[model samples]
Target chain A: METGTVTTANPLNVKAKKESKSKEIARKLLRSWTGVIGFSLIILLLILSIFGEVIAPFDPMDAQLRDRLLPPLTDGHLLGTDQLGRDILSRVIVGARVSVVIGLSTVLLAGLIGTIVGVIAGYYRGWIDIVLMRIVDVQLSFPFILLVLVISAVLGAGLTNIVISLALAGWVIFARVIRSEVLALREKEFITAAIATGVPKLQILVRHILPNIFTPIIILGSLQIGTYIIAEASVSFLGFGVQPPTAAWGNMLDEGKDYIFNSWWLITFPGIAIILTALGVNLFGDWLRDTLDPELKGE
Target chain B: MSDILLEIKDLGIQFNTGKGPIQPIRGVSFSLKSGETLGVVGESGSGKSVTSLAVMGLLPEKKSKIVSGSIHFNDEDITKLSEKQYRKLRGNEMSMIFQEPMTSLNPVFTIGELLSEPLKQHKKMSKKERKEAIINVLKQVGIPRAEQIINEYPHQLSGGMRQRVMISLALLCEPKLLICDEPTTALDVTIQAQILELMKEIKAEKNMSLLFITHDLGVVAEMCDRVVVMYAGEIVEVAEINELFDQPLHPYTQGLIHSRPTNNSRKSALYSIKGQVPRPEEIGIGCTFANRCPHAFEKCLKETPPIFEKGDHLSKCWLQDSKRQAVMK
Candidate 1:
């Protein structure tokens, strides 16, 4: 009996030790070089986006023809001006807000809709699954860019319209990913246990199914943000995304097209901003996927 | 019997596929008296798990349907009960634990949250009351660090620990009926013994009717008061545990007992039953077991056998008929 008590208490101590060791591993992971770089880049981009108005040397829309096409570090314009004489630096700074806002909104709306549809299709799995999955199939069949162009043309170009169209286009991927995940998740013994316990169907979906599929949802969502930022840039470049004078990264790239040869800085700076931000996001998302994966967590 | 806790009569379950309706369980029936632990033992495709699911009203809604049946619990017919009505009884009056303890719990929820769920839904206990109750039950189930373990998620625990948590979850509502479907199949032998011990202790204390389903006959011998032996979706024999071991009536039961590896036979070739269980589509009009039965006769092939009774034991075979037994003697 004494030995039994001692053995039982020892496991508790071991568990406590294991818990603290995991925390240490987490700390060690964040202290790695890639983690520091990725973290800093994301933090820096967020601050610039949120504080764009205060930090911009000039109003992003301000125009002075005399400063037009001036090279970087010329006079007050730190990054010079575009053909419209708008401060390139200010526009790039302000453009981060549009990318982040559109990216986040598109993902959130798409994620919510997809998760609901996927959960229903995966859980109930009869006519509802057939119809919902067929719809997803129909959405996936179309050329994505063509679909976006068609929707943008019908809705007319504006920020809200861009957001709405991207959401519509983006939700299919989320639905497909989440549906596949939930299909596997619903088969787990926990779900049967939940049903046997008489947890309400809705409660089971929310509390059991949703939480179990979150790992995939989060990884997919993080990766999609970077993709959506690029997607928004592409649509705006084609004149079917955010309208002109709004200083979206895509529109900036659009306006810089004519001055590609003479004023290379027009496209160069905004292009770097998009590339760097996308790179940072991708790096961070990849890191998260690896870190959260149980298979990889040991290393 | 007047004291019968649950009665299932003529339970027929069918799964409709693209080809046609495939019946898995045809006319399977049994009754459980109060505080009795009834073991339903069968091979893999014998429909033992399906019977338990039918009782819980948790069969897959799309593919499967209870074709014809009546399930009475405490004198109330539950066959026609709506899902909402079942909810009040489920997890309150009855609950279930399943196999594969490693994957039988939601990965994200802490043990405390999962265990407290039935209490929150059925008992309407306050947060403090629920916590204390949860801790007490965890301790009752022999979890050493109830408070610490409560905060831990399922993945953090070992397989045995998870199963213990599952048993605790099933017992939280003090359910009158507990359906355990191969609950220890996924655990190692040592853990299996421990879980069985825990279950025996708890069942004795609570006096709930346990419907224990397993493929292992040894488990039935150890845990059951009475045992039902199913073959090809039909009950072939039913008897008290000791009676079953003493004189198994049906050929399948006899075959099952013969296949057990006795200590003296360790160096000799083991006895095994011949032929696989026929697929549902392959089953013909006559007795489903006729194709596999060693005692199969012209009548056994030409007609389905009604259950033949002798004293308190029953066997579904022509050989069990008194006239046939008398003639053979």
Candidate 2:
């Protein structure tokens, strides 16, 4: 009925109304305490990742043997120094870049590969479905960490290889979720209507199927970013990720573990940074799932 | 008036199941003239919907195969057309409107987006021209507030409004033939009438041939110039609308007509033909309705009856044989 009155309104007004709807969602998001904290934490991490080198007072890689193992509130070092006397605050600041980059890129690469496999398997079905799903099953049967460790070990250590190995391990979840979504959606009459309308199969997959499955993809991507961040830290701590002498939180933790009994700030700062990033990502993902899920929106 | 827009000859479709291949459609044949509405009346499992899907070239590819027959649309045998060729004709020269309006429109797309698709696919229209055309079609389909409705998603509209949008979608290209598979069965009575009226107005305006598939005999009476009654995947009767209703030759058609509850029969038990329609796999060499036919004889149980023509009316039943009719008289 409101549409009746809005009929006379110009297209610009309609576009404005659409913008307001999203703005309303943003307003609702900020009203919740979890949303506020999670959002702020992510923003803080983003800023740290982008401007870490510029803002860090001391070069993260520079070591001062005389200042080794200094406690918090030392001169020129806010959080103190590591066993190598590297500034803990600067290391933690720069470590955010590695975690965010590895986390975001891994999810992106994994999501792309998985969604294509899923849409193909689901839309075509029969032997194609069986083959792809069996591959997914074989991949999924392995423990998540074991799979990542095995892949990282085989590929050897580096930034790109870690992202690749983690992506290979993480894509199965996305494939499984997206495949099931496509399986359900392909049977809907709208899909048949699209086919009858002469829309090409690829167009149907991209325009119709992909858009419908985007919510799950976004939710899965957000949730997986947290998992990948932790996975990267674990891999890097094992020396299979961003190598030593780098300001990655994982190797920083590895370096500081030796002096943990004497100097607490070394490992404590990096550990807190990893936990905060993961926690923030997970909280934001949960809120996103709740808000975007139409079924849950009734509450 | 005499020009045939579409023709089907002995269309047989088989579905491959785990058990075995079962032929659901067997020797089904019919034709639609350029501006005529042909109603296909049948019950569930009668293969009416399957036949329509075959016509649209939308049948599940790996599962169902067209084992026999040809579908000639506009003088070309569409059954032989490649998928690419079929695409050229589909949603261009011919289009289909499905039964469930609720699920037919993509929920994520706005009405304008849905309508613009067929235009984008088949016609060479610019964005502005397409928008103008979409608004014009929406208005022609009796959708009020067409401009605003175009911006709204499918979920925002009621069932009747969505059905109108679907009609406008089917009409976007001014298709020569429109296949509607029980389009009104899902709507309430009032909405059903409104949709039927809108379709009739559009059909006349466009001079489009309509293949209307429904199990409701009332709809057949109102919308069809000719009717094809299908039972067990085979057409048992084909006749002009008045002739089929007044003198339903096939026992199944008669049973269908008699079973309709009327005020005259308010105090009496409604007449119903006994026995369910045999499934495709259960059909044998004999007449499909032999078990249910009140007038069935030994011959009806032994052999399948061929189509017996009487001027414009055709009936597939042993009872329609001249000798049998004379004996009965």
Candidate 3:
């Protein structure tokens, strides 16, 4: 605004002003495509889990004698009624809540515990590394299923117990991944730089190392979610999951197991739900792994 | 001139593995004068790196260990110091620049963040002081627009730039000694010259002793004030750079000087040593280089040669007698 003022602009004005956002837009579009199918499936389950009660036509617990063994798309039963005359459609749709919750909780809990153990084992690395590694070896030696089942039994079955059992058993994966990452990163100049600068050990782990290893954690976490969902459903199907009449898909699966002989809808419907949900998550994880690591992607 | 920055007496580093205890460096002794640059030149696996790592107390606990050594630093025998004490000195009094700058610096941090890190940790400087220090260090390394560049990450910088950043990090602490471990091997020729010049300038500015470890003879000629040629974990030759280069003493040093690419013609194939440097386990009681030496006589194969001195130039070759006889004939 001042007259006769020779104004020299910032030298990096070209870079700062932004190159044609074409590359960014293209990268985003490319990244979004592979994740779309998985995202839709996840979003659908989340929506169904949230709105199960409000949207179901029948009171999920209501019984109709005549509607028993009704095939899918029959009058009043969109996904068919099970052997108990309970709505199969309502049960599977509501089953989304337990599956989604189990998937999220297991990952969150396991991830938190695993990261802490891994960082400590990796960072200090002396007798600490040796002792921590021994613990990991011992944990791995426990019959994985037996360990989870025992843990679950001791804790007593409910949503919380399932979450606890899963978290305890699943923590080692995150621990191992994060530990290796920290080991490699600890040798790096940034760590030396951190130490040279006198950044505290705790601060180095939390701020420096953890943020860098986040990509692998994300990829592994997504895959682990699929496994957790299947595990939750299996335990529940065995009658150890959500107690019956809770409208859980696994308990519905347990109820339908006996009648699976005469009527196919009970087992088929819930079984299909677990399979489809797990499949979607796995596909999503695959996409993320490929996207995050360009080496894995075919040119 | 006499104040010793580093004095290592009877230094021996051994690696106990499945094979046996591999003694790569045996009874190695040297003193680094304050504000002087000392070069440790050697073939691969000559224990040049191992010696420096041993001095820094940075060798991995899995395999490498100081079997016997007394490392006196600032009048204190620090070889017996604990990890905690060593860690305190590492980025402060004696910082090291590693061989591969690409893998040495963590790729995640901005260059400015990396540069300021030592200041923040050791000094606990305020944010303003940290920023100013980082800018100053970056500028000290001759990086233009260092203020803008400090915010960049390792991968964003070229190999030369990364090495400079490393130098800045090493020099940041105003350490009494800078251990440069093959610092320029990974860079291009032009970058190597620039880095060597930068190192010379910085060492002068800080008046710090430099323990320069390298395999390149040319680099030694340029940056080294005194040269120590190592072979199979022992000092085969030690003297002033010009003294050793002008009148090469050790047979190994003689071979290295002769084998330089410039010494050979365009059509003629370049001279390469006939065999690989022997691994520690494969080495016997005799002179380590005798098996590869063209002038090796029967005595040379059976007994180890002592470090022979003539003026400041030292040589460990049995050729001293046999070559003299051949010359007289």
TM-score of chain A of 2: 0.93
How many Å off is the CA of A214 in candidate 1? 2.2
Q: What is the C-alpha RMSD of each candidate to the true structure, in Å?
A: 4.3, 3.2, 5.1
Q: Which pairs in model 1 have colliding backbones?
A: none
Candidate 1's residue-wise lDDT over A1-299, tens digit each?
Answer: 01111123257776787789789767865867676676677888899889998989999999988778998999888899999798999999999999999988988988888888888888778888999999999989998777888888899999888888887887888888888888888778888888787788889888888877888888889888888888889899998888888888999999898999989999999899888888878887777787777567556
Q: Can you give the DockQ of every candidate in the order shown?
A: 0.46, 0.52, 0.29
Q: Model 3 off-target regions past 4 Å?
A: A1-34, A55-70, A82-86, A116-147, A175-209, A294-299, B319-329
In model 2, state the lDDT of residue B173: 91
For the candidates in turn, chain A alone yields TM-scores of: 0.88, 0.93, 0.85
Candidate 3 — which pairs collide? A196-B118, A197-B117, A197-B118, A197-B121, A197-B122, A198-B121, B112-B150
Candidate 3, residues A75-188, lDDT tens digits: the string is: 878889987688888888888898999999999999989888888899888888788878878888887666777788888899999999988988988888889988988887
Looking at model 2, residue A280 earns an lDDT score of 95
Question: Each candidate's TM vs. the true structure?
Answer: 0.93, 0.93, 0.88
Instruction: State the lDDT of candidate 3 residue by residue for B1-329, as single tens digits.
Output: 34988998889888888877889888798888999899999899899988988877767667878888789988788888876787678778888887788876766667766666677657778777777777788889998877667655677788988888888888887999989999999999999999999999988988999999999999999998999988888888888988888888777888888788783376788788789888888888778898898888787889888767677777777766555658769
Candidate 3 structure lDDT: 0.81
Instruction: Write down the DockQ of candidate 1.
Output: 0.46
The sequence of per-residue lDDT tens digits that candidate 2 reaches over residues B226-325 is: 9999999999999999999999999899999999989888999989889888988898989999999988999999999999999989999998999888
Candidate 1 vs. truth: CA RMSD? 4.3
lDDT of 1 at B222: 83
What ranking of all candidate models by DockQ puts the best one first?
2, 1, 3
| Regions of model 2 farther than 4 Å from truth | A1-8, A30-33, A54-59, A72-79, A262-265, A294-299, B264-275, B294-297
Off by over 4 Å in 1: A1-37, A57-59, A73-78, A294-299
